[model samples]
Target: MTTAPTVRTSTPEERFVAAFELHEGHTLNGSNARIQGLRKDAIESFKQLGLPGRKDEAWKYTNIEKALRHEYRVLAGAPLDEVALENLAPFLVPGLEAHRVVLVNGRFVAALSHIGSLPEGVIVTGFAKASEAHADLVNTHFTRYADFTTDVFAALNTAFAQDGLFVYVPKNVIVETPIQVINLTTGDEDVLLNPRSLVVVEQSGSLKLVEGTHTLTEAKIFTNAVSEFFVGPNARVDHYLVEDEGANASRIHNLKAHQEADSYFSTSTITLSGDLVRNDLHFLPDAENCETHLFGLFLGKGRMHIDNHTLVDHAKPNCYSNELFKGVLDDASTGVFNGKVFVRPDAQQTNAYQSNKTIVLTEQAQMFSKPELEIYADDVKCSHGATTGQLEREAIFYLRSRGLTEERARTLLLLAFARDVLEQIKIDALREHLDARIAARFAN
Candidate 1:
């Protein structure tokens, strides 16, 4: 039997690089120089920034120390399961002939993937393979949007980056079904998986993408994943990300999307469960006449903790953006929502809106919400709002008067509130599946 890698996190930042160096057969960023340089810079930045604590304004409410307080096998995992990949067939969107890309323990598994005939000019493969086949595209898009100078987690991920997912859609090609890129972390060992994906959609092209993160074992693990999307001019893209890790798992999901002129981009994040999950999503309309929408729904119970931080920057004029995030917290769970929108000086005629709503079921549950807007242009329409409270008494009374039990009425109201965001999903099959999942959560 292969011995488990013992990565002690009790020392936090002090032991990470030492542990990373001790891992056998581990090479930083492979043989690619661009990748090597990026990794070098990220490691240096991480050493300076270190791990952020509550003192940092952006991380004031969330306690990230728990992630570093334990030992994790950050370098290796046990052997792959022969049947694990086969069981993931249910994850494929129902009623659609979608291409499936699977990764186990952050390593791509080609034998388990299905790519039956793709649209012309579309490419999806593992990172190492993509780097060999489409070197130019990989050189251009890889690690472009990550500004590791500030975010330590981004820097750490870049430093430890390895084999992940790579996707490209050529100009004018419209993919019929969504592309599913999945990452599953098993209980082979107490490991930490670093998954990264680079997606580029060309001008006039359209595509739908869905990414999922799931756990299959009862081991303690951590996943630090980064995903970047580059939307070209006159293009359209819809992206949905879902994360459902084990009760003993911790994850840091970092997403950054850039939009070109006259392009349309929308993203919805659905986080169902986790021990400690922090999501950082940023949107930049870098050109004029662009449309961007951001939506998220998070549910937490027991000792689960969820933190969602989002930002939208309008760098050009005539851009429109809408942001909404909702959360349901019960037991001793903690929820945090912080959203910020910025309209640059030249971004006149920009229309931006932000709202966050939360429902706390018990007195032990806690929620912290902040919605902010900074406008440098005088002729922009911008608004922000945040509301946090329990279920409305009037609505509960009305439902009970209509012959529904109190518990049933509460469930119905909570489901109705959550469905508003779920209805925005453009894919019918995925929406229905998520609806059933939400219903099942409340059923428990």
Candidate 2:
């Protein structure tokens, strides 16, 4: 028997650092002197920490060393014409009045965005633009919600992010319409896209936001993204992330939310494409009676790999959290899930639950799942479970006995397994669209 080819090993830290240096000299008019200082500090921190390796517990299954061994060019001042924007208009959700914010190649495109009429005390704009238009708000909570010390990708995003979207919903105000953000990347050239988002919902306020990510070309590109959210007392917010990038691309997404007393937060992540993807979600319930829901669905085919890590921290009493994630792997793909729930000593009467289920369609496919619960409080209820298996042979044979083809029966069963999570999406139009997309994938 012949041996497998040896993979070359090289550090990507230098290449990423060089890219930051090239983008740092550019001029940003809205950013003040103090903001510049903070950016510099972030860059310094990123240089020291660098990219993680297999030894790191969080990144043990997902091997970054083998995935990011090549050098990527830094994108600067790329032209984003009107034609590119028009090509994406057909995919927009119909019959809904949405505030559209467009970002091309990690930079905001002002001409393509449609900032329609907004209610009073509601502010939505770019991060660089917020430096001048809303300096106090930007300064107070720029990198306050998420901890970038252990996350190298998040620090890299903060170092090179020149422009990003920022949304602030003031106290006692409700955003009637959803805010939609379209992040498109043309990876014709090898480069890295660092996108950032900061959202703050004041006390007793509510907001709903949806985001869609797509690619235009076929090239090896890296999209490192970070989103920070803060929910005040009694506030409610719903967030959704849809990934439809090309199969040749790779992405790392970090989402963190901080919830105060009596607040509610829900987030859903749907992954349909990408070669190697990792999603990290952290939720902190710092006060009493807070509620949180986390859901995810990922489909992996070919040689793709998808890794998801979620953590819920209970710091106070009487909080509840529930998490469910599902995955379907085909061909020679792989899937990884690591879900952890932590309850501190002061947190009493807390209820937390987590479950992960995966279905492998092919014998060559692989899956790894680990669900953990760490409870420090004596009076709490917590549980975790994980399951991985192939398609039920009896169910498939039953469908075949009804005169259905083998392929058709398998497709139907896969769709039935995924429909439960898809039904959880509240948006009618988006839900229907996603269902159609999943159906079409199986048909082909």
Candidate 3:
């Protein structure tokens, strides 16, 4: 009778290292040279960066210590029994027709996915498959846009980037059908997931992508996800991320994008539910005549916490960028919004705007908003503003005087307050689905 070897690990970081070592031999054995190199580099970077704490200025407002207390293991589980098409009905946006891609516990599930007819030269598949089939393309943009050296969660995600989603559109091609990725977390024990995605749109090409996260189990889940988008010259890309996880789940998402000359890139982040959620969104308009837009909406209740940090870097001349983020907090929930716009010295004729607004429904609910602008170019136009307050009593009273109940009047006012962010959604079906969801939320 021999005793099994002991895996001594204390902190979450140490446990992650141990987990990586355990999975390195089997799950990472067949990876290509470039991927292997990325994993190695990422591990070293993680070691140097470690996990952030309250001292980190960027993460000061979001306290994740309690969320990281569990001993979470990374599971490359696929074809999970609990993840069937029937079980995904609640997650799918009604009346939205699109190609569906499903991932369970960070691994792609082909059985539950549907890839419809795509235009010629447009490739959409699992990351692992793309790595093998389009090695050159994957290698060129996998770790190029999202910087892992400075971000600890990004480094951790890169170290565990075995599989997720991959999309590529060749030059001059347009994908009519939107690509919808549903990320599901289901397990009996606490698990950590790293879902990595890379999307590339070549010059003159266009694409629309939507990614949503959902939880199917009550187990504690920590998702550290990284997604990179590349818009080539004269190309356009629209992206959306919907986070509606369970109360026992926490997520850290890092989204980075690079836009070339004459390109357009827009992203909207809708955070509906989570225990602790933090989103780091960054965009670099590196060439002239590039356009970027960032929009976010977060609704927090039941002691949940949501943090949104965004940055737009104007590195070239004649670029335009705009950002708007709003939040509604109730029942002791807390929210944070920190947005920054940086204009380089050579970025002349740059136009940048940022705004953040929040409504606190209860005295216990709190909000922190910080909007900043750093313009080094004299020819640039940059502005930022933030506001946090409760719903106007006059508006609610007026509706009540019009023969409406107090609760109904309050709900209507909140819905009107959130319309700015909701109206930005280009997809009519998706927008309607979210509008209904929001209305129901306030109605209840």
Q: Considering every candidate listed, which one attains the maximal TM-score?
A: 3
Q: Report the error of model 3 at residue 84, Å.
A: 1.5
What's the lDDT for all of these models?
0.83, 0.83, 0.89
Query: What are the per-residue Cα lDDT tens digits for candidate 3 across 86-150?
Result: 98899899988998999887777888899888899899899888889999999999889888898
Clash count list over all predictions:
0, 0, 0
Measured with C-alpha atoms, the lDDT of residue 356 in candidate 2 is 93
Q: Give the TM-score of candidate 3.
A: 0.96
306-348, model 2: which lDDT tens digit per residue? 9999999999999999998999998989899999999999999
- lDDT for residue 228 in candidate 3, whole number 0-100: 89
Residue 244 CA displacement from its true place in model 3, Å: 0.8
Expressed as tens digits, the lDDT of each residue in 1-444 for candidate 1 is 125766543566666666555542355545476776777687788889999888987888887865666666565334666645557865666665578888877777898777667898799888767877788998888877867888788887877767778889999988878888777777566767777778899998998988888788888878888888899999999989887778978898899988999999999999888888889999899999999999899998999889999999999999999988998998899999999999999999999999999999899999999888999999999999999999999999999999999988888999998998999999888899888889878766
The lDDT ranking, best first, is 3, 1, 2
- Cα-based TM-score, every candidate: 0.94, 0.93, 0.96
Q: Provide C-alpha RMSD values for all models, in order.
A: 2.7, 3.5, 3.1
Q: Which ten residues in a row have the lowest lDDT in candidate 1?
A: 22-31
Candidate 1 segments exceeding 4 Å error: 1-10, 23-26, 29-31, 76-83, 89-93
